[model samples]
Target: MGMSDKMVTVLRRQFEPTVEMLKNLIEVCPDDFWFDAKHKYWKQIFHATTSMKFWFRQQKDEEFIIPDFGKDVTEDLDKECSDYPTKEEMKNYVEEISSVARKFFDELTDDKLLEPCVLYEEITRTDVILMQIRHVQHHIGYCNNILNSNHLEAAKWL
Candidate 1:
């Protein structure tokens, strides 16, 4: 019923849907298709999830200032992308991140929610969280686009 609680609620709500969308995208295409650099579907998901984890760790450390990737942000996700983990690996990544997020939410105090913290050096914590949500949405949109382009369909979320 406090600000922290509300924020955590919103985050938790977004988490499951985001993971489901990623799973759907992965399921729609074969492993080879995901490795295709031309489509960049897996690349988008990889970057988004990896970046999220990086930011989450920074936040937990109360570092406030976000690390800069500089121009690397523009690199195509699929270029030299062989390091990507397997589908099972990705699922484990999601589960681990989700668990950390839940812990952060449970322990977050209302005062901390209101405290101003720098994100990415210039942005605030509030903005960082918002960006995180948007990042999830962006990847999901990419997945939808890929599915559509391939004339494939994602399973409806029940």
Candidate 2:
């Protein structure tokens, strides 16, 4: 397989399903337990999706548009948060950003992978995708902790 093919395989086989797993995890959480100031379940999703979409878009240009979460990221600090979306809306957000991610994979080229990108430290385009995977999984586990402690079933990848 070529470099591009390897990149696509890794994303399709790994990152994509992990995203689906995150979606499944959110779907299974009881509505009552879905939100909490301390838990930040919804906030995590926003951050994850925003970061994924933002960084992926960054690969093309510096002018990246943040996802419309109906509120700015700064609002997350507010004690009385507003403009939060329903779980259904969040699911839709995931689907939308996931499409962007899929497109990134589809357009993957060996040269693109070698392109310079930065996420905390200097990295390549391929490493940016890897960084996104880690970031999403980190938050997924954060949500999982809440679910597991609450006696809710954690999502299993199919």
Candidate 3:
């Protein structure tokens, strides 16, 4: 398979379980916990999704653009709703990020993957993508821990 194809495959495989894990977490955790200052789980999820959106927009060999974590994103996220839509919101966020990933992967050439591009002036594009994946996994692990701490069992997707 081509480099782009391989990357897409790996992204898909990694995200599938992650989607399930997030859903299970939302299902188990209380709405109050999402807003708890100590945990701030929901805020972390929002930031992670927003970061993924930015990264997925990048072209192979292109320098990654850091997203503006300005008031708009944070303000909307902070608004308290009578009912929480954590799972649905996360699913939609993932879908948007996946669309960008598809576009990026489709346009990528093997040579482009090897081309050097800076991320944050220090890290390379190659390292940035790897870090993005790792970041998502880290948040997923945190979500699982939160659920476990609440003595709530996540649904089995298999």
Give the alpha carbon lDDT tens digit for every residue of 105-149 in model 1. 565554555555434556555555667778877877877777777
Q: Model 3: which ten-residue window has the lowest total lDDT? A: 66-75
Runs off by more than 4 Å, candidate 3: 1-12, 15-24, 27-32, 35-37, 59-87, 117-122, 154-158
lDDT of 3 by residue, 1-158 (tens): 37446754664566556545554555666777865756656655766766766666554465654333322235134554333335456556556665765665555554555545333545544555666767766776776677677785643442
lDDT, candidate 2, 52-133, per-residue tens: 8777764444566655556533223334564466788789888888998887777776556776764434677777788888
**Angstrom error at residue 151, model 2:** 1.0
- Candidate number with greatest TM-score: 2
| Best of the two (1, 2) by lDDT | 2
Question: Which candidate gets the maximum lDDT versus the true structure?
Answer: 2
Between prediction 1 and prediction 2, the one with superior TM-score is 2
Q: In model 3, which residue pairs have backbone atoms overlapping below 3 Å? A: none
Clashes in model 2: which pairs?
Answer: none
Task: By lDDT, rank the candidates, best first.
Answer: 2, 1, 3
